[model samples]
Target: MTTVLFVHGTGVRNPGYEETFKLIEKAVHLERPDVKVERCLWGDKLGTKLNAQGASIPLYDSTLALDEEEEDYSIVLWQQLYNNPLYELQVLSLKPGDETAGNPFGEKPGDELNSRVERLNPSTELQAKLDVAGIAEVFEPARDTVIQSEAYHQALQNASEELGEYRDAIARAIVAQAMLDCEQQEKHPPILTDAELRDEVVKLLSLALGEAELGIGDWVVKPLSQLAQPIGTFYLKRRRGIITQSVSPTPCDILLYQGRGDRIRDFIRAKIEQAEPPVVLLAHSLGGIACVDLLVQQALPPVELLITAGSQAPFFYEINALYSLEYGEPLPDYFPSWLNIYDLRDFLSYIGANVFPNKVQDVLVDSKQPFPRSHGAYWTNKAVWKAIIPRLP
Candidate 1:
C-alpha cells in the first residue's frame, strides 16, 4: 500500500497543526482510501518558539506610528471621490447663494438653465467631447446609467437655484459620476485607472458644456491630507495587537531555520525511516527545504515521491543557502521524483523546474486569495490534490 507521510511547514504548533492536518488527512482518506496516510509532525519538536515569550517585539507608541500618513490619507480621500464623484458638487449646491433682485426677463436664470440642462443628452454631448479626446467608449453605458438614477434626478431638482451659477460644476459632476458608476461596475470602455486621467475626463466634460475653468472637486483634498496623521495614529494604536499576531510568524520561522536547522532535518529523517514503505513526503514552506536538503544529502529509498507546496527550496539552491546543494550543482541521481506546487498569488512560492531541469515538475494552482493567505491556501485547494493524487506511487 502507498503511504503518504505529511510533513508540516513553519510556524505551525500543536492545536493549529492538528486543525490543518485534519484537513489533509480527511482529503486523502476520502479520495484514496486504500492509501495509508501518516504525518511526520516535526514542528512541535523542531519548530521555532518564542522562548522569551515575545519580549523581543517592540511596543507601539504615538511617535512610532506610520510615516506615510498624508499619502495614506490621500488614498482614502481619492477612494471616497471615486465612489461618489458628485460629493463636491453636492456640497457646492447646498452652500448659501448670493441674495439678488428677481430678474426682469421672461424667465429666471435658474428656470432657463434648468430647461437647457434637462434637454442635454449625455451620449451626444459627452460623446462628442470624448470622441475628440479619443475616449468615446465611456459615454453610452455611463449616460444610460446616470439618466436612470433617481439620485441624479433628485440632485438636479434640489440644486436648481444654484445650477445657473454652478452649471459647469453640475455638468462636470454628472459626467464624473457617470464614469465612476461605469468604472465600479467594470463597464467603462477606457481604463480610467489613474486619478489624473479621471480629472482630465471631468475637464473635458465641463469644456463640452461651454463652461469656463471651474474648480469643482478641489476643496477637500488639502483638508483630508491634513486629517490623516491623527486618524492613522489612533487606528494603528488600536490594531497593534492584530497586526503583530497576523504578520510575525512566517519571518520568525525563517530566521530560526537559517540560524538552526539540523534538528528539523534529523526529525524528518527519523519519521521517514519509521513510516511504511513507498512513502511520499508532502512538505510545505520551510518543511520543504528540510526535505529537499535531506534527500540531496542522503538517499531515502522508502520515499517514492517528494511534493513541495509553496516551497523556497529552489530559491535557496540558487542562492547557495540549501545546506546539501550549491548554486550550479545538479540533483543527485538517488533523489526521488519532485513535484513543486505553487499559487500565483503566493509570492513566497518559487519554481523549481528551472533550477532542477527535467528532474522537477512545476504546477500552478489558483487559491483565489491574496499573498499571505495564498501561502497557506494549498491544503484546501482542489487543484493541489488533483496534482498530487495522480503522482502517488
Candidate 2:
C-alpha cells in the first residue's frame, strides 16, 4: 500500500483542507483503492498556537518610515520622494494568471531588473559569475598576514552599522535618479527594487562617503540583507488579510518559518515514518516549501514522488527567503524528485525548475481564475491528477 501525505500552504487558516485533500484522495482512490491518505496536519497545530496570541505577522513595507529621516541630512528630500510602497500596489494591479510580458526565459520582472542592477553593484555581479562559473572553481589566495590596529572583523562590523544609515540615504538617491532618467526618456518613472535601489544608493554613498573609504559590497556595507526577506512573505499575507487580530485557530505560519530548520519539520517527520513505503507526499503553497526543506535534510524518510502546487519554493529561493540557501548552494543531490505544478494565474505560484534545476520538473496548467481561487483550484483540475497518477507507486 502507498501512503499519500498532504501538506498545505501559507495564509490558510481553518482551510477545511480535508475537503481539498478528499478531492485528491478520491482521484487516488480510483487508481489504488487500498492506498492510505493521511495529512501531516502541521498547519492546524501552528495556527492554533498563533491564534491564541491574537497575533498576525507585522507588515514590513515601511517606505513611510523613511520619512523620519534627519532633516539636516542632505538627502532627506530624496528619501521622502523615493520610498516606494507603490511596487506592491503596481504588482497587485496585474491580472492574476495572465502570462507575464515577454521574457523568453520566463523570468519575473524583478529577476530581469536584477541583471541591470548587477552592472551597478559588483556584489551581485560577482555572485552571478560564481553561480554559473561554479563556486568550486573560483580561487583567490589570501595575502600574507599583517598586524592590525584592532580586531579587523569587529572594525568591519562597526563600519557596517554606520552603512545602514547611508543605505537609506542611498535608496532615496537612486529613486531620484530613476525619476530623472525616465523624464529624459519621456517615460514614467518605474519602481526601484531593493537591489536596484541599493545599487544606485551604493554609488551615491561611494561619492558621499569617499573620505570614509566605504565601497560597495564591503563586509561593513551589508544592508541587514537577511532581514529584508520576510517583508515579501509578510506583505503578501497581510494584504490578503489571511488571518485577523480576532484570529481563529487557523494560522499562516510561513512568516514564522522565515528565520527559523523550518517550523513544521518535526510534525511532518513523525507522520511520514508511519506511512507506507514509496510514499507520495503531496503539498500546496508554503506547505510544499516546508516539505522540500524536510526532505532535503540529512537522513529523512523517503518519498517516491513529491507533488507540489501553487508553491512559493522557487520564489522564496529567488528572494533568498530560504535561510538554508542564503549562501547560494544547490539542494543536495539526494534531494527527492519534485513535480511542481503552477498556474500563472496564481500570483503566488512560481516556477521551480530554474531555481532547483535538475531536481525539479515544472508543470503548467491554466486555472484561468483569480488569486485566492487560482491557488486553491488545483484539486479540482483533472490535469493535476493526470500528473499525479503516473507518479504514484
Candidate 3:
C-alpha cells in the first residue's frame, strides 16, 4: 500500500497529531482506504532535553546569560509544540510533593538502649574516657535530620524550580533544532547537491522578501495616506535592497544570502529523504516561500503535486522590481505541475495582481466569499479543493 506522511510546519505542538491524523484519515479513507497511513512523530522532547543540557550551565549562572535570540526562538518553538493538536491528550502534568513529613531516607534510631544513651550522653571526652565508642556511635545524631529541615526544604524548592526551567528551555531548543533539521532534509532530499540547495535559497529569499513587501501595506500602513506612504516606502526599499544583495551572484568571500538560504534549504532536503516518496507538499504563507526555495534552489524530487494557497508569491513581485528585471542568467524553472491557489481579496496572498513570471500560472478561487482574512481558508474551501483535487493523483 502507498504511504502518506504529513509534516507540519512551525508554531504547532506534538499533541496536535491526533486531530491532523484524523483529518487525513478521513480524507484518505473516503478516497483510498487501501493505502496505509502512518504518522512519524518528530517529538521535541529529545531536542528539548539536549537544549536543556546545553543551557544548564548558562541557566545556572544567570538566566540573563541565555542568548536572547536563542531563547526567543526556543520559546516560540515550544509554544508551537504546546499548541499542536497531536499530543494535546498527552500533556504532562506536574505532581505535588508528598505532604506527609514522613522520613524520605528510611533511617531511624538503632534501638531503645541507643536512644536512651543519646539522651544521657554528656561531653565527647567523657564518652571517650568511658571506652564506649561503639555505644557512642549508636547514639550519634541522625544525619537524616537535615534532610527534613526547613533549610533543605527551601534548597529542594530552588532545585526543583531550576530543573523545571532547564527542562522548559531544553524542550524549546529541541523543537527549534528539529525544525532546522526538518528544513535541511527538505532541501537536500535523498539525491541533491549543496550547490542546488544554495541556489534555491537565493530564489526563495527573493520570493519571500517580495511577499513581505506586498503584505506590509495591510499591516504596517496607517490610515493617513500622507504619513503611511513615506514610512511604507522606506521600509519596503530598505528590505528590498537587503533581499537583493543577499541573492547577488558573485564570488564574494562571504555570501549572507547563501548562508541563510542554505540553512533553510538543507533542512527541507533532509525532511524529504526521511519520508515516503510521492508526497503532496501543502505550504501556507511564509512556508510557501520555503517550499519554493526547496523546489527551485535545492532541485528536489517532483512530488505527486505541489499546492500553495494564500501564498506570498504575489507580494514578492510587488515589493521590488528586481525579480522582474532582466538579469544576466535566466530565472530558474520550478514546479511544472504546481498549483498556485489564491483568494482575490487576501492581501497576504498577493492575489489581485500579476506577480509571478510569465511561465507560472495562477488559479484564482472565489473563496465563496471576498478576499482578505479568507486567505488561510483556501485549502479547505470547497471551490479551492475542487480545483486542486482534480490535479492531485
Across 189-222, the per-residue lDDT of candidate 3 in tens digits comes to 2101111222222233222212211111111112
Which of the two, 1 or 3, has more lDDT? 1
Per-candidate TM equals 0.56, 0.50, 0.38
For lDDT, the strongest prediction is: 1
What digit string (tens of lDDT, one per residue) describes model 1 on residues 1-393? Answer: 888888877655633466567667877887888888888887676666668766766666422243334244334443334446554445454544334523444444445445555565555655565654334665555545554555444444444333432565555455566556654554423323324344456665555544645453344445556545553353334444455554456666777777777778888888888888899999988889889999998988998999999999999999898888888999999999999999765778999999999999999997654345457768767788899888887
In candidate 2, position 130 carries an lDDT of 26
Q: Model 3 scores what on Cα lDDT?
A: 0.37
**Angstrom error at residue 95, model 1:** 20
Which parts of model 3 are misplaced by more than 4 Å? 1-25, 32-261, 302-304, 317-336, 351-359, 368-373
Pick the TM-score winner: 1
Candidate 1 ranges beyond 4 A from true positions: 12-15, 60-244
Q: Which of the two, 2 or 3, has more TM-score? A: 2
**Each candidate's clash count:** 0, 3, 49
* lDDT of the candidates, in the order given: 0.66, 0.52, 0.37
